[model samples]
Target: MSQNGPKMNEFEASTATEIRMDASRSTSVFLTIYSDFASAEKVWRRFEEYADCYAFQSFDFLDVWYRNIGHRSGVEMQLVVAWGAAAKPLMILPLGIETSKLGRKLVWLGNEVNDYNAPILAPNFGDCVAEGDFSRLWSDILDTLPAHDYVELMRQPKMVGHQINPFTELGLKLNASGTHMTQMSEDFDTYYDEKRTSKAKRQFRSRRKQLNEIGETKYVHPNKVEDIHASIDNLVALKSEALKAIGAPDFLAQPGYLDFYKELSAQSLNEGIGHVSHLEVGGEYAAGNWGLVFKGRFYYLLASYNGPKFGRYAPGLQALVELMRWASEKKATLFDFTIGDEGYKAEWCEIHEDLYDHIQARSLRGVVAQSLTNGFLLAKRTIKQNPKLWALFTKLRAKLANHRDFG
Candidate 1:
């Protein structure tokens, strides 16, 4: 169990039967399962005011996702809400049920796009869980969930909003990779200098200069409805083409993926839940991007460029620089590159956060599914951690793509 998890004394997995503690103890907790977010939206939002959760867990973000993606894809919401004594809200488990190859699987809402998945916890959740047997609560919650072969809760961090994430204990498998981020100072230049060497800074400036030479370089943040939609559509197209060129399955091709982003960006970007921006060279689109800014952190999300032709001057990186500056101007304290081990992110991240995945079996098929899934994850872990293996894999993938007439 993670050190931050509820106390383990008298804890036996799936043993506790009590769903509600004696109210006199003031640690009583109850769980409710909802098939739709609307049934649980009020408490979910109420907890967000005092809960510790990433921006992705915000009610608005999830609501937008549900309306656009979940409902469209037939992803059923298994939204779990917990209440403490006097029925005070304490936690929200944003879960969903989807049919996977193995069987029906229970997972986090927006798991398809979210870099991290975790339950939003109120400030006093730890105390309540410690006072009550969390094992029993968790067991009851799982028992109440819809039928599923197994559960996969991955990419969960130990800390969220600087508070212990209760899910850390569940996602026992330590991910080989993690999220990348750079903490910002009040001054953008000071922060940039610390992350980049003098030569590297000069190189970046030169790249920007060259791009400028080609045309009047501009970083465009489109707030107008038409511009945002156009920019997002362009970015999606660019990303789709890039994936095709590399022979990778384009997620944009998936049902509701484009709608999820475009609608969210249009409705929530101005509200600070989403952001859409791009870089233009000589009055033409070079790079288009979408990100999230919430609670003083900027989460870098979908980003795409025209191609290596426009990539010559690194317009994507330039846009990031501008984003960093923009974030600093807004007094944002962190610029999160999110979850990727890409070389470009390494150039800017000040910290790397370890991620974890928890897979559990509840049935015979679930057991077999768990074993197969673990094997795949172990292989992925091995490849991700070994530089040579990753290089060889990439080369082999390229060759395979070429053989398949994709290159």
Candidate 2:
């Protein structure tokens, strides 16, 4: 722990709530909160194995994200570990503190970019956390941290594998949008036929024909280091341009964001967590898609295609189709489009899983913050759900972008 950071002594002094499971059960549950990331890293892997952990929660991914983005943004780490009397880890809640417009808030690590968030649970321990246990846990968590406005946990899945998510029992609000995913079939043809209507399939075939006429198109996943770097660079450039064209804030404009993805791509290639796929037209890059493969699931993360030159051929859609086919060929059980409500995603997805957000106030100031934040989120959701309002918002955003660019 850093010299200025909270110490174990401080944590013990602040909150030391003993959790009892049941009268018949002899073991007692205890909580340990750490303000430093290194302490949490020591037990992270072992605890991760106790439950069904997502790739986003892996130490590698979160550490990288924090080092690159979170730390720079002045977010403080708060890792909560629960253990039984036998010294066995039960659950790991990777959380952090940051001062937002609402006030000082405690949130899950990777809350900004992660699609799914939940407390890492021990195997078969999901249903074990009852409301009483959670209430105690929540209180203990608040006690460990400095007085804050709200505890906001967002983008949590309702289930982890076969077990129910214990957090859902705590009564978090349903997120405005849910994640979209498709169950992959045994073969590409079967998956494609199942996802697309006859008309859509015909249109896809026509698009392919047009693309072929332009040049020999090939789908490739770069394996060589140089090739991967080049592909990632191309993706960054394309994505930056696309964001600029639409008048939206360019997330990739920051050097740290670019470096994060580049490092992620390299590390993912090394660890076999994911890969970057590209579509080449006449041996020249036309489109790129980066996705992760974990536990027989393909997670679509980032994708972009060539500009107006290749727009007519629908290179983006073509690349997505090729990616789906690749996932099917690999026998992936699911193709998760992550979080979005785009029309194209709905066309392919059969499963729409609700993500959730939890907001709780600890103090009077927190209640005010919670109310303001809730109202803001509700208004934002209302606008997003209304097509006309969303369209107008986008046009206004684009005009603002243009003014900013030309000013």
Candidate 3:
């Protein structure tokens, strides 16, 4: 085991510190704390190479997101990295410390925008950690983290790259809803036939026929940089309007949200990971989708369509069909509708990937905070899962919005 200070990295302007601890008589692990982003970039770049990493955990994606969005939003980076004996990097827990009404809390970095969150573990490490070793590791992490009321980790997958997520092994409550996904076939025809029911296929065909009647419709995955930017802009604008119409807060309206996407899009252009697809009617963008392709899976992230103009034709559904065909052609094995259980998602996806939320209280105040937070989440989840309750809630929300808009 080795110990180092911030002086090792010249770019370390913030407090750069490292600690080494023995997990067992024979096994030792070292933890490094990075307060500055630049100091961690080199290590994160190497850690990303392990096949266990997902696109959302990539340095390129999170770096852009953190710089543009998280940094300004009271998020303080506390990236904890662990390395095994011989300095073999094992995992990177990208965390941030923030102060809220409850108190100082530690959370997973990119928790706001990231659909799937888990420690970026090295290959084969998740299954190798013994129960005792994990307990020691968790202790080490808690000791290293700055003073906080609780540790809250959300949207964690049960497995990453076929290995059980170590976080789940610690025991956590299930998140509100499971993410939806579709397993793709080798060919688009086979996938469409297998995933979509006979009635669904008929409806899709009818929708496509209706779309064609509007104009010369085209489904396009834009590779050109300019087109990508334009497509993202269209998606944000359309989505904002849709949210307004539904009386929901427009996420894109939030500070730095649009910039985060634009930055991520630009940075991911050469990597072929960030993809922007669009359905155009009469040469005008009718629907757009921004997604990521990593390790043979396509993550459907954000999507929007000109609902008022194209709702009758179901242009969004048409765009999704074309996108699935594109994914099949690209040899993608799965199409994950990242973190929602909308009825439309169920129509296309049969697989449900459960996510978990973890909350560990450290003190007396933390216990009270945790209980309150947990109760609120449970109530919110109950409402969300009940169709009648959720519909009534939305109706009320819409009426409130109407009052605000008209008054």
Candidate closest to the true structure, highest lDDT = 3
Write the number of the candidate with greater lDDT, choosing between 1 and 2.
Answer: 1
Best-to-worst ranking by lDDT: 3, 1, 2
Tell me how candidate 2 scores on lDDT: 0.77
RMSD of each: 5.8, 4.2, 2.7
Best to worst by TM-score, what's the order? 3, 1, 2
lDDT of 3 at 8: 36
Model 1 residue 315 lDDT?
80
Q: What is the C-alpha lDDT of each candidate?
A: 0.79, 0.77, 0.80
The list of candidate 3 runs beyond 4 A from truth reads 1-24
Pairs in steric clash, model 2: 50-123
TM-score of each model, in listed order: 0.91, 0.89, 0.92
Candidate 2, 127-182: lDDT as tens digits: 45555566666665577666777888888898876667778767688787779998
TM-score of 2: 0.89
Q: Which one wins by lDDT: 1 or 3?
A: 3
* Residue pairs whose backbone atoms clash in candidate 3: none
For residues 11-35, what per-residue lDDT tens digits would candidate 1 score against the true structure?
Answer: 2122212255445674456566667
